[model samples]
Target: MADALTGVSRALREAPPDRVVEAADRAIRSVLGASGTAVFVADYRINGLWPVVDSRQPEVADQAGQSMVQRCFSSQQPVRDGDAGGRCRLYLPLTVWGERLGVLMVELPQEPSEEVAARAVDVAGEVAMALRAADQETDRYRRARRRERLSMAAELQWELLPGRSLSHDAFHLAGQLEPAYTVGGDHFDWSLDDDRLTVTVLNGDSIGLAAALLTAVTVNAMRNARRSGGGLVEQAELASDTVYYQHRGHRHVATVLLELDCVTGRVRAVDAGSPHLMRLRGGSVTRVALDQQLPLGMFAETRYDLQEFDLDPGDRLFVVSDGVWGADPSGRETYGQRAMARSMRATRLQPPTEAVGTVMRELQAFHADADLRDDAVVVCLDWHGSGDREGG
Candidate 1:
């Protein structure tokens, strides 16, 4: 008995699920001289049994074995009996952590003995212990995989950022990122030229790694298109094409691009499957809705229209990523467009940079403790200074 216990303990410690079940079957057959040995697990959904390992009857082994194992699963106790032909039929329930996992059965050669019954019980107990350990290990591996993906995404987000605040005489732009364990595919950029500033805010799909990669590629491509120089309409056309071709075999991004003339406060933009930019004038919020274009990479043939508006002094123009508009922090209630407009109007007197920060903070509070789907960017244009300047 001591030798059997020692062997079982060692096997339980060193063997994986498959090997432990195999070893237990061998030990039971050797000890009892049983004709066949079968190990079955419980399937709660079917209210039946499932054979994990077997020694005989391949054609209908699992089916026949499940019939007996299912019965043991409910009782969680041994079903020991002798057939009419004097063949010993043993069903030893397998349990661990106060839960019935399955059962092991052994059909003895002729008649059963006390020794055979004790050994079969030992085998069932040892197998149950091994399965519990294996289950815990599998759960650990799944958690690690989830964390690894999140880490990769967070790293990508940090790399794509410009980092510091950017402000000019007419407008000041700043953004804040909520703590996210996973990668979020949201970003914004504005480049200031002599008489014009090109601003863009984007939020791609929630595809994790793939979405993060596309966001980075599209951001760089748009930067290149603007630096390469052209008309506002021309830049939008080139940027749309660049995104379509760059993500040729992959996913796409939803974007909104705005061109604001520094001298005249003239605003022209194209919206590609994104929310409208909100403009606050005289304590009232109005949406500067542009014609919708297809999301980047969806079609090679989509075109964008250039909608223009003149920016008046004290006009607060706001552009934001979807994280602000779509997120629900309290685990309920999404922060919709109306909420965002209110947030903008409330902070109209503050500097554009600080106002953007306030909006991000409010969004974080609303979401309760949940992480955002993608990065949130709020760029506010106050059209500061004299409105008399004109150029470009």
Candidate 2:
């Protein structure tokens, strides 16, 4: 009997909060030979303690409820005597830090004596200590998780942000990335060389270990493809080919590439399966419906197409990733092309970063506090060949 009680004490001391409560209830019923046991926690209203776990007698289990527990809580003392109506009912208040936390009730087959009352008190004290220890553990876990998330968020932001903007007097370009996690698959890059201004975006819907691999492949493939001897069309094809060959036809990816001449303000683009690119011109938005090609590495028979256009001084071109299209409000209403285009038209006068932020905020509000399902990227390119528009 002493050894069993020692084991119960050890369990209460070592277990977490949930386990501590469970162990306390189990020990009382087993050691005291109680017919039923209950653990009640005080409600926020402070008027009562509600039973969390109720072990009731088969004869009167249905009749006994929280109200029956009122006298024990009201007296703020243990009730164990022949005067009680049932076989035996013992109520011991579970207190901590000079405050009553709740009540622990034990129903006995006979009136409990002084020996049982003393043991019940000891058990209640152990339960209180266990509850405190469990609270401490829970608090520690919450702090650790908060710190970890902050660190992850910081790392993700640092990696995705470019060191500087890729803008000059002739042409201006900027982009924004908003991930639903610490790391996301939406990425855009722009490198200005002596020959051409290379621009690319890699939109990956990957996650977990696969997402990490996709990110590495996307970054390395873009760098290698841009450095290869090629135009935008050739570079995009090279990137697709590299991914396909590297994955051995096991994985798939989506990519786009563009080369703009600083002198002529001509924009050449190669779309390799991504969301439609929108062009805002003269107070209106136009969806440049490039051909829908297969994602990279899907199959050997996939083909790509290239398109070009002359950029007016005030023209704005927008490239979006699949994350935007995937986010649906109430899981039904999509922030589709029409909505995105409208947002584009409305924010045409805003800077690239602000425009993207506006769109993201709108999507967030539309979802009504739901979490973003995917990472999103938005890149805006504008031609300033005429030097007629204000910088934003």
Candidate 3:
């Protein structure tokens, strides 16, 4: 098992960017004595899985196979089934540090023993790590994951994201954006350092490429400050000043910056403009009120205030942009007034990763399945609290 794993890792390291997946497939088949191997990656929308090779698109006709693959991906578990001619097919989820990349399907000569199955799971983990590393070197995996062409603005926004989800012993965090292919301004980002976690959400006050650019600048400014050992106040101030100098009061971005002490469930925040916060504790959901400051870039040298809050273990917090809560489809009722809360309640049992997506789906349904008029961002955080902490 060790030799096989080493061979696979060596192959991945030696392969060129575009050939990484092919190299992995060949190595797995040779090392594991498998008849066939394929890597399937979840599409951009997370609605379908597409083979990394030998297929131009996801197989829409193969409902059974698709379901099996989806199940493995969603549950982060290995699934086994009988293949043709007494062979056994194994679907192993390709996940790394809580991120669901896709699945690795292997067709073995026969059903494997428990040890072999365990080895396959380890191999899948290695492959996922390779894929994550390859992302910087090639766009092959990214292209395969996209079912449709992305608008320039959407491309920029996607590139600016820290990631779709992150997990830790203290918290589970996930976020999503609506109008995936053409998303404009709304964006979210986060960083974790030891027991401290920082999260930011931005709602650019513009549309199309302009909004994308605004968001990009603001995000980078905040990131720069954060990376320089700055706290919420510094991040907010630096971002505000940068945006203000760029647009000179003509453009602005509504944002919420949060810093959490993982051990104590203490949170400090800076709320600038439209992104709103809500908390779910026990069974009830209520808005988290913060001092609203001027949107970034609204004026030169705008001073921002920091607000403090605490979360009990098992508490879930959501930060949504105005595009979500203020969504008024065809002049009807706004989504935040009721539908959003109902959606949150419905998905309370789900992990943050799944809950974020479910909430976005509900938002779409509230829009009557119409394309969202504005870009929307939703971020969910579940605080599990730290084990070493004395009190909740």
Candidate 4:
């Protein structure tokens, strides 16, 4: 065990940026005495798992939905399965603090002794942490995980995001953007400060480079407002004002900004031109009807209204862009609010991360072969509170 870690440390210290994942794969496989190894990262869009490193193949299909990988990731436990021919496969999930980084698979030449199995588990954990740290230091893993090259617009939107999911003592939130490589100006941001959680879900009307810049400006303004101690209305106002003056006198941004007192289950939000917010509680979904407001940059002096509400325990709030609700560009068909409601209710029990994926899949299936003419996104926020506690 010590030797395994020593080798990993040496690789970590000397491995070049391009070979980090390859080195990790080699170390894990060498230490396990395995014929080969593969590492598959879970994609944020839930389109499929992506192979970041595999000794046998240059690229591999998304195998996360496969029985073994699913079992390991969902159960947060290692799985050992042997086939009828006595060939053994070991699937170990690499995760830290409940965030799944990827899965490590090893093809054992022979049944491992108890000691070897224990060592494999240790190596899995170490690799998970190493990937997380390496991801920050190098783009090797990022490049490997992506299925295709992103357009400039999609690249900007991707750069503006804060991963796909987050959780805290009082809440769990997850979000996904569609048309991964071609995604335009659809993005989400959240910050957990003490007991307060600030969230922003944004969509831009323009596409390509224009949509990307509008999203960037809108997100930065919202972040500035939040960090400056602005309330929900103020946050929306700042973003709107910035876009109004900055977008060549056009209202190019639509958004919903939220400030939640997680401890108290209180939420305050400003909804502009984005799709109406949907709420799921007790297995029922309802569309929130707030006063209509202009998209950011639409009106110079527009004062955004704040819709204040208290959530019950086990309540989920969902936000989606117009692209999702109106993916069928032809006015003849509608994804419709009721259909959206049904989708949310059906998947309310899943973790926010899985819930959004299912919803997106359903929506895409409904739209069939139609392309998303606009940027599409979904943000799911789950609050599990007593609804009676007061924030200190």
Local accuracy by lDDT, each model = 0.65, 0.64, 0.87, 0.76
Question: lDDT score, residue 152, model 1?
Answer: 69
Cα error of candidate 3 at position 138, Å: 1.2
**In candidate 4, which residue pairs clash?**
none
lDDT of 1 at 103: 73
- Winner by TM-score: 3
Which residue runs of candidate 2 sit more than 4 Å off their true CA positions? Answer: 1-164, 300-303, 386-392
Candidate 4: what lDDT?
A: 0.76
lDDT preference between candidates 1 and 3, better one: 3
In candidate 4, position 257 carries an lDDT of 80
Q: CA shift at 17, candidate 3, in angstroms?
A: 1.6
**Candidate 4, 85-134: lDDT as tens digits:** 77677888887644666777776877778898888888777777778777
Number of the top candidate by lDDT? Answer: 3
Q: What lDDT does candidate 1 reach at residue 269?
A: 80
What is the Cα-based TM-score of model 2?
0.56
| Model 2 CA lDDT for position 119 | 84
Model 4, C-alpha of 40: deviation from truth (Å): 1.2
Candidate 1: C-alpha lDDT: 0.65
lDDT of 1 by residue, 264-298 (tens): 77888878778457788979988776777877667
Clashing pairs in 2: none
Off by over 4 Å in 3: 55-61, 388-392
C-alpha TM-score for every candidate: 0.56, 0.56, 0.95, 0.84
Residue 107 error for model 2, in Å? 73
